[model samples]
Target: MCATLVGGMDRLKREYINAAKANGVELKVFTGKENCISEKMGQTELVIVFTNKVSHAARKEVMHYAKSRNIPVRLVHNCGVSSLRQNLATN
Candidate 1:
């Protein structure tokens, strides 16, 4: 599955990417909210947002775009590798 990960620290982003790789999931991570554009949304099957790390406007925009395109989105408060793993594992 291809997923777009929005908002996370550099270290956490790397960890999430590594974890996703290990799980056979392709992940495209965007550290800044600005990178969560509509163009990128089209390439992903899922959208996971780190709620605490991103701006409200950016989050809203992402949610709106994802919903419009009928893509699934998961929002997590923590931006850790474990959290990402658990979320992906369940869905």
Candidate 2:
């Protein structure tokens, strides 16, 4: 499953989701509000926060929830390798 932070919905059109779809993957967009985001999280396997604008509240809540569920979080800007590098740099 896939859910993006606010402003990441455009990725669905920017070719990433399309590639996933071409590879026969199911991508889901989180359209609900704050409380709804948690509910949506339950149905998803991972949360990809593409936008830096994600609120502090959402980040803390989602990170905690995802951690408890063993769900991985990814921040993909364009490619997977660069994302990994960025994550590693942050670490």
Candidate 3:
């Protein structure tokens, strides 16, 4: 499965990707500081937003884009690797 992660610590980006990969997910991560995130995030099956770490504008933009495309969006308040892994495991 493929997923796009919005927000979370930039330093832990590698760890996040690794964790997702371990669970058979191809993860693309955006640290919420990039410009035009919606455009940059290519085709993805799931959109995971770290609500606590992401800017309101970025979150809104991602959510809007995901909704329009009919993609599943998961909002996680805790921006931890474990939290992400847990969510992915369920799906």
Candidate 4:
């Protein structure tokens, strides 16, 4: 599975990455304004996006990329560790 932290969302990106790794999962954090999401997803089996700003475009881009790749994606709205567990469990 592939995981990328969407946006800077620095507030929680670090913790998210930490938790993901703790579960033996590797992840990439996207801190740029507009990143090459599609390309990033290419190397990943699944794209786990964590963000507070859930815009229509963001939602579309994420869903489109994951769906197109036939890779399952789980959205983490908060930095709560529980969400990470649930997300990783599916993988």
* Highest-scoring model, lDDT: 3
Could you tally the backbone clashes for each prediction?
Answer: 0, 0, 0, 1
> How do all models score by TM-score?
0.89, 0.55, 0.98, 0.70
Model 4 misses residue 90 by how many Å? 3.5
RMSD of each predicted structure: 1.4, 5.8, 0.5, 2.7
RMSD of candidate 2 to the truth, in angstroms, is: 5.8
Top candidate (TM-score): 3
lDDT of model 2, residue 19: 50
- Tens digits of lDDT, candidate 4, 16-88: 6888888788877664356555676556766666565545566678788778768777776764656766777
Candidate 3 on 4-42: residue-level lDDT in tens?
A: 999999999999999999999999999998989999989
Model 3 TM-score (2 dp): 0.98
**Residue-pair clashes, model 1:** 0
1 against 3, candidate with superior TM-score: 3
Error of 1 at 59 (Å): 0.4
